[model samples]
Target: MVVLPMKEGDFIKIEYDAFVKETDQLMDTTHEEVAKEHDLYNERATYGPMSVVVGSGTLIKGLEEALKDAEVGKEIEVEIPPKDAFGDRDPKLIEVFPMNRILSLPEFRKGDQYPAEGMEIRINNRTGVISRIFAGRVRVDFNNRWAGRTLVYKFKVTELIEDRDDRMRALISSVYPHSEEFSFEFGDEDAVDIILPDIVKLDTNWAMAKFKLISDLRKYMDLRTIRLIEVYMKREEEEEHDHGSEHSHEHDDKAPAEKGSEGEKKGEEPSENKEASTDGEEKADEKKE
Candidate 1:
């Protein structure tokens, strides 16, 4: 059986090693050893074949275009020009900020030291690196690190995913890359259900993250319902009771009634004796009359 060349809308997993063409600096790789050597080892990251939707912007334009005719199990080394890779570096992205302005950021405190050169900082919702600091001013560069540099990638297609389960897994991995575990259920009516791990459910950004994940998944698969399930065990919380003082007050109120009942019982014999004496006097007076 002959496998067709990769085309748009196909999902493929590939093992790739990328480098800067000019400097030969390793930019990215799937191999664990290479990542360790480059001090980029992330224990949480999945250091293996990565999934990509062919026409999706999951990859740079050049790399995605190269995969159009790529074959499985065959290594291909492609050189991408700066224009097609990260784009030419623009001087406009390098802006200067006053020392006072930099100090006024939310991350900075009144007595905190100002950011130094080579430090990354967020300003106006954009992240930039401090390239220079002098004369009460700082230069922040917002350009991509690889901008104005060509990129070289050696990659091979490891697997072509067609199974619905694998495709769903790929979609999840793309969105929640560091997710621990998740399961999927497809119904007869084209509805989908995803059971996320407990850890993911605890994320603070879960509301926004879930929305983006569902949006990305819908781009590839049509579904009537997508249920994202997160189950959590509720901690047994003890209800705070303020009835201690109230109960004591109730006991105090009942004490008078209890004492009155005891007094009535104690006085019953004297009252009966007095009534008997009165009845005898009345009978003696009637006989005398």
Candidate 2:
């Protein structure tokens, strides 16, 4: 069978295992068992085939260029240099900052201590890693982690996406990475409903990214309506339980009023009996006169 080469703007699904060439360290993989075997399973990360638009800059330049003419179903290995992968490390990217300055940020101020080494933090919208901790100052490196390393990626193209819904999903991945687990529902009026994973829902940047993705998707696809599906866990369900409990408590508080009304009815019954007894006594007195 002859296979056509992947071209630009092609939506393709690929499973990959990426490594650092120098140390052969496993950087990332899309297989679950591989991650578990290597003790690299991160509960937060999704494991599966990743979708990408070829030549869309969604992937690193080297990988994108390598896949431009690659065949589907066949595994391919490519080595990407730092320049093509993450850019060469620059000494100017390293800087020192006072611990007090870092602690002044909202994300750090509420913490008990400065972040430990290798911890990534953002301050004033710039992301940096803590390289060293000192008495009153710390060293931060703003360079990308793979900036100076060559990346070796072994990947197999799984399939080419042709369906409009599938294509929209592939394009949405650029905005919301790690959303391979999302499912889709088609509706009338050319509408699509995207059911997102719980992890993506919890992302702090989801709100802002969602609006941007909506706009971008509207421009990219011909759909008339797009909706997000939110699946809540125990905590969100607990909120409903809380509301019900609150209503129950209010009913309990109003119980005394109900009892008061009953007490008034009890009091009126005795007064009626007393009035009947008095009328009977007056009739007897009139008969005797």
Candidate 3:
């Protein structure tokens, strides 16, 4: 079989481990075991091969350039300079603020005495980390964490996504890591229907993820129309719970009436229970519907 060269717009899956050359610190990795060994495990992160569209600029300049010359299933190691990786640290990016000013920020208003060193904070819509705190002053460094450091990446391109549907799925997964839970149906006229999982609708970042997915799909796939369908169906357990709750209230309401009827049968005066039996019935019916 002839192997085609990877080019721009080609979708591929890659697994990599990146490190800072100076300290040999593992900056990032796609392998869970490697991250754990390096004490960089993040429970919230998804560990596995990551999908990428070549030359998309989603990756750093150096890595993207290196991927162009990479072969699928062959592990390659490359050293990237500060210029090609996160750019060299700039002295101008460092700023010192008065301790009072730092304390007055909204994030620090929770009765904290002062910003701790290494604490990340946002000011003027820019994120920075506190590098130092001294007498009446706090230094915030806005440089990228890995700035001025040489990066080493050991990576392999696992698979090239050539099928149209598979390409679409990879693109979607790039935006939302949980794309496996979504359903896709391609139609004529370059239109595709994406049936979103119910869980995604509740995510705070779902809107932003959707916007990026649409932008990528249009830019890469050249699709004309995209439809995101969200289906909300009541589960049988939920329906049963609602019905059970309504019946429970109804039973409670009848108990008092039944007791009153029994008292009357014994020729005793009926107790005056002023509470309305239909009070919660309307609310329960509304909830069920």
Candidate 4:
């Protein structure tokens, strides 16, 4: 299939699987129902590029580095060496802490984990926290659980689609499925009743995700079918969860990433905000009949 450059906002479609080096058996994957106990679950691992922000820390370091050179919709095979993928068993990473530290915390279960503070945690899997007490010291290995394994990844990119407005609507729906947040506005000063919730602040990245979705929706004329919707920004809660936290915490289920929420990035400078916002308004106006 034809491959395109993976733009910053391009929606990536791809599949990945990890194979055992010795047996070539498909040990684990991201596709099927992952047991509460394994690395990858399905024989074939697959996930959307939505879960990954390119050049970011979503995938393995080697994979990330490899994909940087990868174009969107381009299928490529990359072999990540153990050292590049996870790294040789870092002798320094393994540690023996005072057993009291492990036994003291009520939340310190064998498999439970928290930030090592500046330490990174791999997404989609439980942190490996095997706490064994020996000679008054608790052995804790901070190295990646699959540190010594070689991985062969085949990325068959389906397509590189732009993030558009439908994607934005979908994103809003994803975040606030229970609440209704859509309305139509007739051009030339018509106000429609909008039940915008107590606002939730958005970080720059999330805002961009929403912006791109809007753009894509416009491209498809999906928004044209409706009158108009003026999306206003508000900060509903003073408290905001770190977007990164969304990945680390185990939600009841993995909320499927929908294709929506496209527009622009949030940034500093109020004067520019007025200009960029007008651009968004113009976008809405462009859809007006």
Candidate 5:
């Protein structure tokens, strides 16, 4: 069995732990047990091997480059400088504002106390953490929390996803983890159809996920068309009622009119055929590229 090295556009599952080189502080990991051991576990996060397309620009520069030519099931450790990880911190990113200005914000105006040091805040579309609170002044640092720190990563490519359907499923599950039961089918003329689960329709993140899924499909797959099918079937009771009505209407003179109306009703099928090509996502693809 020959294990080929990963290359651009390869879909693979990876597990990694990232740490700050200076303090050896664990910044992130794919393993749940490691996160628990470090007391960095998040109740909302799903921890496990993550799916990624190599050279898709989803990973930090150093990490993505390291995975390129790496074989599956081989653990590799690499040290990444600030330049390739998060970039060096810039002093210009630190700004000091009048303490009164911070206190006057809408959040604090409602009786909230002065923000304590290390508290993160978002203002004017920029997010920063409170670094200092001096006499009548508040200093905020907008640089990334890990800026200027060299990072160390221990990672391994666990599995290579080769099947087209499995690759699509993996990509979808990576973005929307709850979509394990979703169905994918190849259609005529280089098109793929994805039948979304009913639960996804109720998700508030569905809109964003739909667009992201479309973008990723276009980027990674060679499909000319991507369709998201949302099926809203009639309830069993409703179907039974309609069936009874149709049976009675068959014996009536108005049956022809009723059948015509039913034909019109069934025309709603077009509404369920949501094609990515028709949506404005092609423009988004251009912008993303």
Candidate 6:
């Protein structure tokens, strides 16, 4: 049992499946094995532990209050209404941006969701571009993408590790799965130095994923930064001698050549040459033994 004190606004890591409607229908799943999924944010978006400011608008009022004094290892169900959640989608929320403006940008394509400068939006996975445009304001409705939809979240508090360094490691590992040898060191309590094996090549996007993983943590305590340290891979030495040679396979077929110049005449008789070849092969086998 975790008897640790859980004060208001204390950071906690939880694994939650966000679903829609009553019973339980999870729409997004967290990849963390311990506890790190969020119902409000979509998958293509940056994913990490959902940080709730205890009783802030970061989440619904019900959830902020529920986390207080919450016991670790206990599962809790939270239901948020449209008012508490994103609220009903007002018609004004969906206005059209300029058709030309939308087409000019690279990300404003079908299937991609891009929010206005100050607006928040979640992609619905339904691919579509601006089909209609009315005004110069480029009628873009800037509403919470999930507005008008009720959400249910089932969460289990895996831990509440207050140590900054420990939390940094946990956060980084969630995004990047490492199975091989590695080492870690801290930088003045604000960064984690990771020594990944040289043999493991990380793709560019994966590297950026790691960078963004740290970026989310920066929103919290400005606590630690994740850095890559050079780790020399240990190469196992190969032994030259074979310890077990109980059984051997050697076919005595081709005879050894006589030691003479390429143009030397065949001085020895054919019988003598055959006898010399046999003696040389016997000596070779003896050397091997």
Give the per-residue lDDT of model 4 (tens digit) for 43-117. 333333333344323467777667656765566778878877777777776666675665555454554754343
Candidate 2, residue 51: CA error in Å? 1.6
- Cα displacement (angstroms), candidate 3, residue 45, comes to 0.4
Candidate whose lDDT is highest:
3
What is candidate 2's CA lDDT for residue 1?
A: 26
For model 3, the local distance difference test gives 0.88
Model 4 bad stretches (over 4 Å): 5-10, 20-28, 33-53, 65-77, 107-128, 131-133, 166-289
Candidate 6 wrong stretches, greater than 4 Å: 3-13, 22-24, 29-65, 83-145, 162-166, 173-183, 186-191, 196-226, 229-289
Assess the local accuracy of residue 105 in candidate 5 as a C-alpha lDDT between 0 and 100: 77
Better model by lDDT, 5 or 6? Answer: 5
3 against 6, candidate with superior TM-score: 3
Better of 3 and 4 by lDDT: 3
* TM-score to true structure, per model: 0.74, 0.66, 0.77, 0.42, 0.72, 0.44
- Candidate 5 C-alpha lDDT tens digits along 1-289: 3275667888988899999999999999999999999999998888888888887766899999898657788889999999999999999999999988888877788885658899888777799999999998999999999999999999988988888877887788757877577998898747998888988878888889788888888888877898888999989999999999888877686778889899878866755554644576778888899
Q: Cα lDDT for residue 274, model 6?
A: 89
Candidate 3 TM-score, C-alpha based = 0.77
Lowest-scoring 10 consecutive residues by lDDT in candidate 3?
268-277
**Weakest ten-residue segment in model 1 by summed lDDT:** 234-243
Ranking by lDDT: 3, 5, 1, 2, 6, 4
lDDT at 40, model 6: 45
Candidate 3 wrong stretches, greater than 4 Å: 1-4, 104-114, 202-204, 235-238, 241-289
The C-alpha lDDT values of all candidates are 0.84, 0.83, 0.88, 0.50, 0.86, 0.56
Off by over 4 Å in 1: 1-4, 104-114, 202-208, 236-289
Residue 110, candidate 2: C-alpha displacement in angstroms: 6.4
What is the Å distance of residue 166 in model 3 from its true position? 2.4
